[model samples]
Target: MTASVLLAADNLGVHVGTRALLRDVSFSLRAGEVLTLLGESGAGKSLLAQAVMGNLPAALRASGSVTLDGTTSRADDARARRPRWGRTVALLPQEPSLALDPLMRIAPQLSETHELVRGAAFDQAEAAALHDLEAAGLAASARQYPWQLSGGMAQRAAAAVACAGGARILLADEPTKGLDALWRDHTVAMLQGVQRRGGCVVVITHDLRVAEALGGQLIVLCAGQVVERGDARTVLADPQHAFTRRLVAADPARWPRRAAAPASAGAPVLSAQGLSKGFGGKPLFDGVDLQIRAGDRFVVQGPSGTGKSTLGNVLLGLMPADRGVVRRAEGLHATAFQKLYQDPVASFAPQITLGQSLRDVAARHRCAWPAVLQHLSRMGVPHDLLARRPSQVSGGELQRVALARVLTVQPALVFADEPTSRLDPVSQQEAMAVLLDALDERGAALMLVTHDDDIADAVATQRWRLAAG
Candidate 1:
């Protein structure tokens, strides 16, 4: 008997203006199977998902066939595919925070989806959808607004909504990004459960470990074309193509180890005493105190909802503390936030090139532009990228650029929040090495917040845990 194909994209192509985002891409998803799309940033992973969902932007054009339930069609047939769209294929985009509305309650969004997709009354479907939420590990989140939920909770809620709609084929873009290890494992298990129930799932990610964990089948994409496709384990273990080999070789878990302790003694660079923060009659952190000496690579680790990122924010002055004090012995400090808040396209003034942005930041701190450019080179950002606007760069490049800007300021203390969460393993290593080396030269202190143990173990001179009581 022939295997059933739940979804298939044959010879698909997508073009944004004159640039071809994806070309001649082909893949298929079967019931009870997961096909992970692995590639670096700018490899068209998200764009492929959009093309499959018929949600490509207005400026882009798509060709070839995207078939659901064995029915093949072009862009013009999108309307005909509408009724079966959400029910047959559901998409979970990157950045759940942006995906959800801050003002809307979770239940209302579910009710609205049910009404629009199934033509069912809100009251009628509320009970069943809540059951779905419970199964998806979001039982108590019904009444909460998006902002009220933790990052992991919000991602799970988004997944619950997709599954609750009875979608047979799930397209998840970076589903585990920014989640703690516990939540990441749980989310992957839930998706596996979906596959066990005879559903099809496709996960788009740059993290090879995520793909390895969700083993079924794999398709490696580079520059919009498939470079390798086979059993997940086999492809990863013995990759043939140069790009695939490089990806497998670049796993952060396999990176070379660096001595955790610094050889030199230096003065205390940063100190915090009796740090405390509370919200809604509950304490997020209580009397948390820590100090960092020069040459120290300190790491802060914690589970979701435990306020690790919150503590980072308070230290960086992005958010204020309810009580206690944070003091930096050195006047210079730079921070890379866990979440990307600034508009990438407008991160720098439209009129200014990327190089100018770097120069402006360097000048503000009395650093020379030549030194800044050299620093950027060490971070693997070519001078050509400096001539381009932030909008012209991919998410990973944009993040590196942001870090480059921070480095240009020549800070004596640096705080990096989940800096490698969205970066591919190779880029993560390169970025970390550059940042650490620069800090060492300036005798600066480093404070890193992350969920990855490998990262904590590799770079930290001191490690601390935040527990949820």
Candidate 2:
């Protein structure tokens, strides 16, 4: 007998006033099945997830019906489904930093979810929480606060909390964003575990590898409409839509290798000596010496929790090393040193519109507004998005805007901490092009952290590999 549908969305749409962000999006998932949503940045993929979760932003409106476990409810009435959030339906948000509570530690958060949402006893909840963290390879991070863990660690922690409620239907949005290849595979396996348990999973991601791995249903969206829908393996292997083809082609693994930029023969823009750092008494790296010359591209690669981001922060002078000295070239404006954070949303002022934030950056750095506009245009970011606050826009959109803002300062060096992690394949290519082009024009140096080996190979003039200490 055919299994019943566990989750279904009928003619779902999202809007802000008269502007349609998503239109007529629909899908259905049964137990032991997976549904993957694929699209470029700002293509309404996340909006669709929010519509089904009944968690759309207050400013935006949703329309349609969502059926879960044989109960149907209007998508727009968020309150009607509030009680279903954890045990029935759970959403693993795109930004783990924002999803986690700053004041709380990791283990307790999972335990609480199990206790409150799943109605498990205190002892069982605590044990289950520990087990979940261990399975996610975040056992060491169990005692750490969300802010204390690295971006990848926090992401895994967030996944544990999201699933602790034993929800039958999971909506995971970019769940593997900052994870390394090993952890990425681990996350996919975790999702597969959901399938083994006869639960349904809906994943929204730009990673083709994920969709191909899941090998279930796939839906491709473009400009707020479904351009294609079919089997994941079949569609990804032979995409009919032009946009889908471009997306598939844009994967970094398929990109042609370019000769790395030649070593610059000039004064070093930044230098560090005998650098060492650690987290929670664990040494990440030690006695690391480095020199970054103008126009040089340095890519840092390592497994998740190996302190890839910590090294970047240390080099950028954002955090002090346990033992190290960093020297910058004299006479360079402090503003000339900039960073693109791993989490772009946290970098912007949440209360203000994106336009106001960019305007402030332009004013502070004395960059012409026209230059900002030009950067935005070149990156394919529409001007109308500027009116929205940071949280109102898509993660990929905000990442590009962050890059544009960084370029406005004309920085002498950029410490890019997974700047393109949130972007789609196409947008990743475009954004990287703009960034490298701008850096080449300005002769700026870049120290980048990335989990994508293909991207690191394509972009790096030099490589820095960190090991777990």
Candidate 3:
């Protein structure tokens, strides 16, 4: 007998105060099937997932029917689905840093999910948790807190915990955002494992490689409307819609090699010698030395937990090196060095609107508010987004806003850590262009940390690789 439809949504719509964010979206999923949502940033992809899960924010309202395992409920009635959470449904949020509890150890978090949510015994839970961590290649980090793990490692841990409850219906939002190729494939395998167990998955992502790999059903959204829907491979291979075509073409693999020349001859912006860093008595990287010149683009490339971010922090003086000296050029303002953080939400004040945060930065830098607005415009950030707090906006939108904030300071050097990982291909290209253009205009140097080889190839004048020692 054919497997019954495990999940179905009908005429789903999401809105805030009559302003529709998502409209008339519908789909169904069966056991062993995967449904992937693809869209540009702020195109209501996440909102749709929230709608289906009955997890929309308080200000938003959802209208539709959500059917799970022959039971139907109002899409907006979150309470109706609360009991099913962690049992029948699970959501792997986009930002692992925020999703994982800060104070809890990774192993304990996984153990709790298995014991409490899955009704496993404590001993069984502990063993299962360790096994999960090992599968995610985080066995050594099982005892560590979320903050101690690198972004990619944390992403893996979060995935493990999300799946620990034995939830058959998984909603994974950008699950592979910060991962390297190995881990990316591993995550894809994990999702496939869910399918092999007769479960279904709903994934929201901008990663075409992931969408292509999942290869079940694909829905491309634009401005909250379905622009294209079909088999993932066929649609991506020969897109029919204009937006879909642009999205597919915007992949970094297709990007032309940059013609920009190295500015190594320019005056040094910063220099470091004999840099070393480690965690828990294990060295991540050791004895690294480098110099960054004005107008240079330096890329820090490495696998997860190899200390790419640690090196950036050490060079930026945000964190001290175990054994090194970093020298900055004289006559530069204290804010001459700014960083576009990997997690943009952490950089802003949670309680304040984005506008207020930008105003404060502008005031500190003696820049006009209009100048900040102009920078936001250059980065394609909407003016209305300024009214919301950092968590209220989409990740891609928040990332662009962060870059715009960085540019307002006219920094002499920028440490952009995986800055565009959350963005769709089209927005990724645009954001990179804006950043490079702004940096070139100001003759500023850049130290970028990313796992994307295409981006490194497209932008870096110099490359640095870190390996665990």
Query: Between candidates 1 and 2, which one is better according to lDDT?
Result: 2
Local distance difference test, each candidate: 0.76, 0.90, 0.90
Question: Candidate 3, residues 255-324: lDDT per residue as tens digits?
Answer: 8777665565579999988888888789988877889999899999889999888888887888988897
Model 2 ranges off by over 4 Å: 1-3
TM per candidate comes to 0.87, 0.98, 0.98
Residue 464 of candidate 2: its Cα lDDT?
84
Off by over 4 Å in 1: 1-3, 75-84, 118-120, 128-141, 261-264, 333-377, 381-394
Clashes of each: 0, 0, 0
In model 2, residue pairs whose N, Cα or C atoms come closer than 3 Å (at least 3 residues apart or on different chains), thus clashing, are: none
TM-score ranking of the models: 3, 2, 1
User: Which candidate do you rate higher for TM-score, 1 or 2?
Assistant: 2
